[model samples]
Target: MKDIQTHDRQRLAEKLRFLEPDVIEVITTNFCQQHPETKEPGEVDTTHCITDARYHLTFLRTAIEFGTEETFRQYLRWTTKVLQTRNIPHHVLQRFLEEIFHALEPHLTDSEKLVVRTHFLDVPESGLTERQTPARSESPLALHQEVFLQALLAGDRHAARTIALEALSSTHSLSDVYVEVFQESLYKIGSLWESNRISVAQEHVATAITQYVMANLYTCVTPSQPSKGKGIITGVEGELHQIGSHMVADMLEMQGWDIRFLGVNIPHQAILQLIKEFQPTLVGISATMVLKVPIVRDLIKDIRNHFPSAATPRILVGGSAFRALPDVYRDIGADAFAYDLRTLTTLLS
Candidate 1:
């Protein structure tokens, strides 16, 4: 039975490679037909059509390469997000998944058939059943962004901690403050620096203050229970942005994962050594700049080559770099790419 399963998995991979172009065409055609609004009259290219086709193609490639329950779920969840962004109805997204299944049916072996049947075919059609995407109202912490920013700018770590603690003391989840308060504030700071409204030194000072504030809140978030699993979060070599990765580390730590956070610009040797020593269940690497992307890709390549198949950790990639470049994570060999803490939580959940 194991041998049969292995053969079927390999067979599916091969078929996916050979049939990709055809599969993409099928998916794109179905998507266009289902949502005629996606097609613009007398236009050589439409945003929806291009994005839809690329999304399906990337999904197929990533799904085939990873072929795990977690990866499959990421694909589905990402599809739902894409559909929601386009303001397309949830039901249309449901039909899209169904079309992908139909498009690949002929290529699936009996064993593969059962795999997709359970994971894809019979999976919850939540997108189809739901009338619309659930509304995500503004976070209450967002209302205090000005206060947080002011404190950080003033280099008042005390004031920042007070604000964060007050939010955490409220009904808000730790995850909420991490996203709205820290992430969004840093984003605003960066924008200010970019527009010359704030100096580079000011940006650095604000970020340092915010990091200090995050440190102070750690005691509040530290889990009492045993760890769920081990996790390693870091910025790839040549990547200087550690705050984003640090936020992820905190989130995982709060969730009771024995997490090792290797701060900015860690070498491949150190990372590989730690992974082998720690044998973590998950590894998250971040690259804030586009130039650092190649470092991430190389890191993944080395990890795959050095580690035995079973011992390999589930790799996740994130950062502003991937946020700007859509679907690049699929090509970079990471199991999943999270655009932010919210998506990261969803991916892990």
Candidate 2:
């Protein structure tokens, strides 16, 4: 990577001053035209688009001029604050960075392009390190792993349910079994697939078995008599992994929130509609893949724009994606993050 100190910010500033107006206009026009259907009367319309464009232009100029890791870090902090408070989508950051590249590409040389791409854009989804299964000290569940694995691989939902129900009957609360047993089982199965110890079909079968067992356990959850608040939970668009988010929804339900759990792969517009209809106090979004973090950001941003400031729900995000990138959920503009179900319960409580 090129060192930031060696570059002349003045030169980039001069270029940016010249280009900023046109860049903003181009971006605003294109963004508005592309997402006209998102516009609501007296809400996120032309003025909001213009404001977003201006913000994007200012950030890009600052980044190119400063060109430092610290600058990007600070920007992320400020941007995340806006995301949490103002309803800016995470993808808007990505989109703005991309637009800057398009605007500057014609006038800038290759070296300058590299700096912009490296410093402000091109963040690896799961961050810098190679991904690994989180290290754990011991199994939290009481069930025999060998038997659970056999039942899952054999596609015996009844056996899986029995094991889970047995745990519930003995020492495990629903939450404990979920995190200790089901989550652990999924993790082990995932590891097996990673190491070629299990077939994709077997891994899928395990997931299905767990899902069935989860449903069996659901009827037993007893929330406090009065509801705490309302919540709507979902996965981002194109994300099919519903288990983690569903676990959260169930936990929240047990905690006395009126839960409207919309599972995996919900469209953006549909989420907004639900937010309008459900009128939740909290919105829990989950994404399993790094790429979908942008979608979470966008979802939050859209929620901010679509709802009145007071009415917009507090956003909570979790899942493997956040676990892999420790600081990313904040960057995505979530009000808070739940690293695990225990943490989630505490945050909600």
Candidate 3:
């Protein structure tokens, strides 16, 4: 898997994304035609097939680009549970995956074909049946997280803000509020959506509420000490998840690092220009989706190319993208990878 060339992975990912709509149409249409019973009244809706196909293709693209076949397999296992929750037959999923492989087989190189076959196509149905449940933490802030999550789920931004502020006023520090309450609650909301227990709208609302609360809490954040150095943090291009980066920015600001957060989907040239203008001591990049890992690599490469080796800022990376593959930062030429604020502080020290 590591032997797969970078350009080949990038090319395959781009090709898969480009052919997404056509491939989905071919697979879904053929499945409906061959399994007409799926479209019968009260049976599996064709819309579900289209939705699943889109997610399937996306997972495939990310897995290919990141050279993490386990990512795709994990997605399959999770989707199996989600489909079961929705009353969709397991065989329908199996058949759809087969059709997808056949649809793309003609376009793949012999080695790529073998990869798809060996990693994706050969998984036993029995192996995919394992169900996973979200774990409960018995930490001091778990109760606060539960209440905060409920408030967000109810779209009560005001209540959520109160909860967060109250937690901050207690024994919890600012970092505790951010990590234990805000971050943990958001993680639960995401898991609920993934397990098909919550609608997309609900997830969005919960996220928006959390963002609102975070902003409200920011007013209370004061630097514990004088400024140490300047830092610029941003989510990589095409990475829409910004809250993690936002949290990093705030935490660093509170720790007395002068921070300029550029938000999400920032272009590489724009980032390079900013680095030149700001001349920060640290450049922090966040990528949430595995699909954006290649973009992060390319961005880091471009940064290295644009600046002289001695003049380059220490580039640090974090976010959920690297959670399953922590050493990916080393592979991508990053100076360091920090999993959270604690590790970030250690790295800077």
- Please give each candidate's TM-score: 0.61, 0.64, 0.87
What local lDDT score does residue 191 receive in model 1, on the 0 to 100 scale?
59
| Deviating ranges (above 4 Å) for candidate 3 | 3-22, 32-51, 129-137
Q: What is the lDDT of candidate 3?
A: 0.84
Clashes of each: 0, 6, 0
Order the candidate numbers by TM-score, best to worst: 3, 2, 1
Candidate with the larger lDDT of 1 and 2: 1
Model 2 segments beyond 4 Å from truth? Answer: 1-135, 140-146
* Candidate 1 vs candidate 2, TM-score winner: 2
Query: Please, what are the lDDT tens digits per residue for candidate 2 over residues 1-349?
Result: 2245424654765677788778767766666556553243457556666666666556556445434344454445445444433445556555656776787778777867776677666755333223354875766563455567678878899988887888888766888888887887788788667555778898888998888888878987666544788889999898999999889988888877898999989998999998898899999999885546667888988998898889989998998766645565665578988899999889877
Q: What is the lDDT of residue 166 in candidate 1?
A: 91
lDDT of 1 by residue, 114-206 (tens): 766665445566623324448667767776777898887787888888999898888887788888888888887875664457778999999
Best by TM-score: 3
What is candidate 1's TM-score against the reference? 0.61
Error of 2 at 24 (Å): 30
Please list all clashing residue pairs in model 3, or write none if there are none.
none
User: How well is each residue in 27-82 modelled by candidate 3, as lDDT tens digits?
Assistant: 87688567754453566568756776888888888787767877777778877877
Task: After superposing candidate 1 on the true structure, give the runs of residues whose Cα lies further than 4 Å from its correct spot.
Answer: 1-137
Q: Kindly indicate the candidate among 2 and 3 with the higher lDDT.
A: 3
